[model samples]
Target chain A: MTLWLSMLGEALQAMSANKLRTFLTALGIIIGAGAVVLMVALGQGTQTAVTKSISALGSNLLIVRSGSAQQGGFRGGAGGLPTLKTSDAQALLDLTSLNTAAPVVQQGAQLVYGPNNWGTQIVGSTDAYLDIRDWTLQSGRPFTDTEMNSGMRVAILGQTVAEQLFGSADPIDQSVRIQKSPYQVIGVLAQKGQSMAGSDQDDTVLIPLVTAQRQLVGSQFKGTVSMIMAKANSAQQLASGEAQIADLLRQRHRIAEGADDDFSVTNMASIASTMAQITGMLSILLGSIAGISLLVGGIGIMNIMMVSVTERTREIGIRMAIGASRKTVLLQFLLEAVIITTTGGLIGILIGVGAALGVQRFGGIAVAITPQPILLAFGVSTLVGLFFGLYPARKASMMKPIEALRYQ
Target chain B: MSDIIRLAAIKKVYDTDAGPVPVLNGLELSIAPGEFVTIMGPSGSGKSTLMNILGCLDTPTSGEYWLDGENVASLDEDRLAEVRSRVLGFVFQGFNLLPRIDLKANVALPLVYQCVAKAKRLQRAITVLERVGLARQVNSLPPKISGGQQQRVAIARALVTQPRVILADEPTGNLDTVTGQEIMTLFQDINKESGVTMIVVTHDARVAHYARRLVYLRDGLITYDGSAADFQEALA
Candidate 1:
């Protein structure tokens, strides 16, 4: 232990004598480690942000959308595509397999609440939409089934739309116009913020499906309902619900065997799994890119170490000829390399984590500084030093004692 | 007197670009434990080669070289280094004290190689330096001192190991007459007081005068071997 400490002291003294060169040599490694950690943090941050947004849409909700083709071939199967209708939703609701089922119609239009006008989406659905969206009325009551069935000219505004329309005034019972059609706002939804897809949930307005179908468009036969929403009783029952829904939808659409279904059913469990997989993959991709910089830094360490070996050739010879074994010499140089690179790696990890914290603290997005990536970068940095240091240490140890004594 | 060193018919050859050149040929010598001997010869007379062989830095091509009854010629390179560390000390003409380290560290180097404890090695180094009248210069570096002082430090380094013999290769070759005499008097004092056998290689008669015995070599062969009085008589 004392000998090793003396060796380390000597190495540090030697490096201190040439401070600028040593710092410059270590700079590459620092940047490499820092970049690796930064990439991982950013990747993890993005994934977390995306996952948080997706989870906000409620856990047990599954969405079914129209497939690419239609059974009737109307409008070249673009508009008349095979879709989930009101009947499919009712059927799922009536079954003991599902918890809740709702049909939806979506329309993008310019909304005018008093003098303030904004481009927003208007959704038409039953009262069950609030549960699927994880929303509650902020102040007033929600729309009733009577309104939904009778196609009443009553509306429910999302938090953002209500704020813009009414400001501090109560938006409930106030009137808002959707494309020249004035409707009384019966309720205001709680702020649900943004979805995982970057769409603002609070920036929308909702009304009865029949009102939207009758007053907004006069019911032109375009296709099946836009989408369907349903829920399973529990997470464990999700798979069974999915299987039952798929079978029921398949039978209702009456597709023959070997024919691909014309509709897509997206279960919440599967959607969450798919999204998590994508986030994980993206995180790894980004982390690997950072890993490349560390590799470059390792190469830099090796290159500079080679130069150091050449410069200290006589010193190496003097030590070896005195009684230092080849292994001793090799270890000395390797230790020096490891010392420089590991220090750089440690500093880089700190900087990466610090930067990640800074982003999290100041920036609106959440930043994740995971320990696994930091440790991975650190281990890789040491390996890089060892890998690069071997060649130079070998060269130093291979020098003949007599020739070393002869070297000026 | 105790016979401590012996060499029998030791020969060394170097293969150069020109061809093989023999440096030592059929040389036999021995030194008593407390003897002070001076080896004198011309530049190419192979005195340095003989010194290297005696120092255990190089091996003879053939013949038995023994120190204290151990045949050094049979020892491997690592064992040879061990022998050199424990039994033999070397002082080169260049005063090859490591300049990068301080005088104490340089002197402690051999002891370190011998795995001496730090405190004991340091204490012994100080004692040897004091013996050589270099006690005050213990903390100084090689280059920071004069040529004579550097050689004295080298001598202290050699003596710190408590070797049986000190090999001084042209000990005064790089010093002035007065400094050379001072160094010679130091060597004679250590030899008389500590009973350390000394072999000094020199070309100058004055430096050779300090040796109790003198050997003259010519063309890789010893031509005269006797007491200092006989060498003076032969020169006369």
Candidate 2:
């Protein structure tokens, strides 16, 4: 071990004698490691952001959307099918397996507050909408059951809509007009920002289902519901809940057992797990692509080492002639290669952590730079140097002492 | 006197495309400890090949060669390296000091292969460098020192291992006459002080005169093996 230390010391002295050459040789390894770290960080950051957005919708929840019909040819969009009705939501809510349920209807129109006008989506839902969406109003409460039943004119403004219509001023009890229909703004929801799908949660209005069905949209859209959302009692029971709801809806609609159910239901936990799996695969793919660059870096180390062998042929002969074994000569060069790569790997990891932190600070996403990947990067780099450095070191060691000594 | 090295019926043949060529053919010789010997020959007279064999850098094709109480002729490469490190100290015509290392480090390099302790190796190296009159230049690199000084450092390196014998292959080949004579005087001092045997290979008759005995070779045969004075009288 002492001998190894001395040999390593000598090798380091030799490398240090040529600073620019050493630095340039190390550059390839640095870039390879840096790319690996940064790519993994980006992939992980995107996955985290995506997961947070999905988790915001609450666990154990499922959304059932109306499905399109297939014609004699292919299907396009919903295929102008008859819309879902409030009765379907009612039937699903009556099921004992469900936690809470709400039916939704949506319309987009120009909203006017004072002289300022902005186009915004207006959604119609029952009082159960707050429970299903996991939302709580920040100011005055959402309309009560009586208010929803009586079709009272009140509105809950989404954050962005509130900002556009009322600025800093509280919109509670203020009035906003939609399509010439004036309504009292009852509350402004807490900022929910945007969903994973990039839709602005704060850019919409919420009102009672009956009022939106009658006043703004008219009878032609009566009995037409866009979607139904409900929570299961627990994630374990979600599948049973979905099955029960599907059977109930089929019976209510009087559809046959073998026929297509004309609807689709997705559990939130399953969606989140699936998204995480896809993201993890993406991270690995990107990391492997960066690994190719590391391979190239290994080749670069080999190239430089071959040149070093040629340049130091006389030195090798001197050492060998002085009593250095072939293994000693081989190990000296291998140690040099490993030192360069391992140091480069460490520096690259530091840079990666710093970059991830910067992205978290600026991008407002929870980007975690874990130690496992950093260690992995470093380990891979040293192995690369050792593996690729072997051939050149072997070539150097195999040289005849006489030939090496005579080499000019 | 103890016979430190012996060669009996040794032969070294090289295969050429044209034919086989013999460098050393059935040579027999012996040398005792604490003796100074020089091998002299003209160019291509196989003197360097004989030096290589004597230094344990090359083995005879067929021989019963013994060195320092061991049969070194049949030893493998690694064993030969071991013999070279433990039994022999070597100086080269080119003054082969590793340019990257300092004088002290170069002198200490052999002990590293021998697995000597760092502190002891450094101490021994410093002592040998001082013995070679290079104590003040211990930290200097080979290129930074004069040609005579570099040869001194090489001598220190060869002597620092404190082997039984020093094998110098044309030690003064690259030095001027004054530098070369000074180097020979230093070698004589080392041999006289340490009581170690020295074998120098040289074509120059003046360099050979520094040795107490000279072995003359021509066409792979020893033509004369006697005192330098006897050869000088014969030439005159």
Candidate 3:
């Protein structure tokens, strides 16, 4: 134990004597580890952001839309037939497997309040829409079922639309013009930031379904809706809920046993898993690129160690003559190499985490600095040093005392 | 006193492209305990090879080398290192001190290999340094000291292990005449006061005179083995 301690002391002294050379030798490892840590953090942060956005869309939610239809010789794309109706949404709510259901009619409109004007999507749905989407009003009350049935000209502004038209002022009770028709703002939705597609989720307006169909979309689409948003009782029930809804829709539409259903249902869980897989691949690719730099760093260590062995040949001879064994000499050199790489690894971690935070704070990139990758990088660097230092340490230890002593 | 070093029929052959080159051939020698012996020869005369064999740094090609009762020629590399650490000390002409460390650490090097505690190692190192009149220079680096002082530090390092035999190869070759004599006088004092076996290898007859017994080698064979006074008389 004492011998090993002395060896360590000797190794440290030797490294300190050539501080500049040691730092230069360790630079490659520093850059390699730093890049690896930062890349992983960014990837993790992006994954978290994606997950947050997906959950904000609502938990265990599924969107049911009308599929394509054939009109004469022309094939109409998704939501073309408008086979979904408010009655179908109401029927889904009766299923015990589903939590709630809302009939939706969506359209883009220019919203104007006084001189402030902003283009936003206008969504028309019943009071249950807020429950399905898990959204709560920042202030004011949602439109009641009575108002929805009566086709009242009342609106609920999204956080983005409210900011554009009202700034910091209270947007409740304010009048906004949509589709050239005046409506009273009843509520302001809380901020939801961006969606997974990078579009602003809060840039929208909401109103009763009857009001949208009668006042904005006209009475031609009276009983039908563009889509139905339904929530499952639990995450595990989402698949069953989609199956039950599809089977019911097929039966209700009276499609033949061999014919295709005219509606499509999408589960949010599948989309989230796919996004997670993509981020996982991205992190692996970044980690591999950083690994190449670590390889180069190992080569640098080997090169410098070889040079050190040659420079200290006479010193090895003297130590051997005095009583140092081959093991002792090897340990000394190996310890020096480990010290260099370990120190470099520590410094790189600090710089990488700091850079990640800087990017998060100033560059607007989400970055999460976790401990797993940091420990992994540190362990890899130390192993790299040991592996690269082996050959040189062996060479130094195997020197013949006579020849080494005579070496200039 | 029993023999501390014994070599019989020792030979050393170096393999080269031209074929085997023999440096030492069938050499025989022995030294009793507490003896001060000098091996003298010109370059390539195998004196250095003989010193290396005696110091346990190298084994003969085929021979029996017994040092202090154990046959060293049969020892493995690790055992040879153990033997060297426990039983022998070496002083070289160039001082061979590590330039980066202080004199005290340099002197304590052997004890470090022995796994001695730091305080005890430094204490023994200082004690030996004082014996060589280098107590004040313990903290100084080897490069900062003069040639004579460096040689003394080397001697102190050799002594710190408290080995039975001290093997020096051209111990004062790099020093001036006065410094060389000073180092030899220190060696003579160490041998007499401690009764330690000393083997000094050098080509300088003046340095050889400091040893009590002189052995001269020529082409790997010992040509003369006698008292130092008789060897001096023969040279005169």
Candidate 4:
């Protein structure tokens, strides 16, 4: 240990002699380490954003939207056909693989409370909507079971809708007008940030399903819904849950053999997996680019170390003549390289983490600076030093004392 | 006394692109413990090659070499370095003190290589420096010191290890005549007082007079090995 410390002192002394050259050599490592750390933070941030948004929609979900409509010969787009019904959503919970299911019927409408007014999408769902989305009320209570059965006009406001119409005022007991129809706001939803489609998730309201179907929308088909959102009992059972829903819906609709599904069963896990793949690929790409920079940095260390070894050949010879062994010489040179690279790497990591925080604070881009990436970057830089320092150190150690002393 | 250093039929050949160039051929010599000897030869007489062999910097091409009762001619590179550290001390023509470090660090370096503790080695270094009549400029760098002072520091470095023999290769070559004589006198004093064996190689016969014995080399052969006083009297 004392020998190692002594060698370290020697390394530091040697490096201190050529400050400008040392800084220039270390600059490559600084930039490489900084780039690696920063890229990993950004990549992990993007991944977190995707995962958060997907999970906010609901966990292990399968959204069933009406396939299409045929009015004689003129075909309407998907969601045009009123194939899904509120009862179909409730029936899905009977399967053991499935959990809570909620029916959603949405339409864009202008809301007014006093003079302030805003246009937002109004989603109508049962009380199970909160449980399915794993959401909570910021204040007040959800519409009761009694309100659902009698088609009462109780409402719950999303965060944006509450902010727009009330503007810091208590909105729980306020009456909001949706197209000249007054509804009492009983609860307010918590902030859910943004959805995957770049739409504000909290910029809307939730009203009872019966009130939307009968009082607000008043569709020609009495019990039709636009879609049914169902969650699996567990993430592991999502596929089976999706299959169960498809089978039940097909049996109830009484479709012939080999007929197209009247309603499409879209597994949300596929979208989640696809998003994960894109972000993972992005992380690998950024990491590989950073790896290339590290490689360049390692080569730079090798170049400078080779120069140092050549310049100090006589010094090596002198030390060897006095009794320094090959291993000691090798260790001293290797330690010099490691000290340079590690010091550069430490500074680079601090700067990278600082930059990430700056971006998060000023730019509002979510950047995660986890310890895993930081630790990995440090480990990689150390390895780079050892690998690149090896060749030059070996060259120094292998020198014949006589030849080295004789070298001018 | 048993011999402190012995060489039997030492031969050295260098493989060159031109061909194998023979430097030392079938040379034989021995020096007892505490003996002070000087070797003088014209350029290419293989005097430096013989010094290198004795100092363990280079191995003999074919021969047997014994130092301090150990046959080190066939020792591996690592063991040879150990022998160099424990058995011999070297003073070079250029002082060869590490320039970046202070005088104390340079003087203590051989002991450092031997894994001596910092405080202990530095203490011994200061003691040796004081013994060489260069008392306490421990923090001064070699570049800042005069040629004579640097040579004194080199001598202190050699003495710090307290080896069995001190090898000087043109140790005073870069100094002025007065400073060279002063350094040679210091070597004489140390050899007499500490009973440490000394071998110095120089082109100047005047520097060779400090040692009690003189060996003259010519064409890889020792032409004379006898008392310095008799040799000087014969030349006169």
Stretch of 10 with least lDDT, candidate 1 chain B: B76-85
**How do the residues A182-236 of candidate 1 rate in per-residue lDDT, one tens digit apiece?**
8998888888887767778899888888787776643553334678888888878
lDDT of 2 by residue, B24-93 (tens): 8888889999899999988877888888888777888889788988889988777787888898998988
Q: What is the i-RMS of every prediction?
A: 3.2, 1.4, 1.1, 1.1
Sort candidate 1 into its docking category: acceptable
Candidate 3 chain A lowest-lDDT run of ten: A214-223
lDDT of 2 by residue, A1-408 (tens): 887887787678878977787887787888888778877887787788778888778667888777676667766465145457788888887777788888888889889999899899989888788777778888988898887988878899988998898888988888889888889998887787788888898899999988888777667768768788888888788888888978877787777869777677778888898999998887888888888887888889889989989999998888888887778888888888888888877887777777778877997756656666787889999998798788888988887777788899
Chain B TM-score list for all models: 0.95, 0.98, 0.98, 0.98
The DockQ value obtained for model 2 is 0.63
Can you give the lDDT of residue A361 in candidate 2? 90
Alpha-carbon error at A149 in model 1, in Å?
6.9
Q: How much DockQ does model 3 earn?
A: 0.75
Model 3 alpha-carbon drift over 4 Å, by segment: A95-97, A110-119, A174-184, A257-260
Better of 2 and 4 by lDDT: 4
Pitting candidate 1 against candidate 4, the one with the higher lDDT is 4
Q: Candidate 2 — which residues are off by over 4 angstroms? A: A54-61, A67-82, A94-97, A109-118, A175-186, A220-224, A233-244, A257-282, A352-368
Q: Per-residue CA lDDT of candidate 3, range A1-408, in tens?
A: 887898997788888878898899888889878887888899889888887888999888999998887666787899888888889998998887899999999988899999999999999998888988889999999998788999999999999999999999998998999978899999999888888788999999999999998877757678888999999999899889989999888988888898777889999878987888888788778777777788788889999999989999999988888888899999999999998888888888888899999999999999888998899889988998999989999999999888998899
lDDT (10s digit) by residue, model 4, range A70-125? 66677778887789888888788798888888898887888988999999998888
Question: How does residue A257 of candidate 3 score in lDDT?
Answer: 94
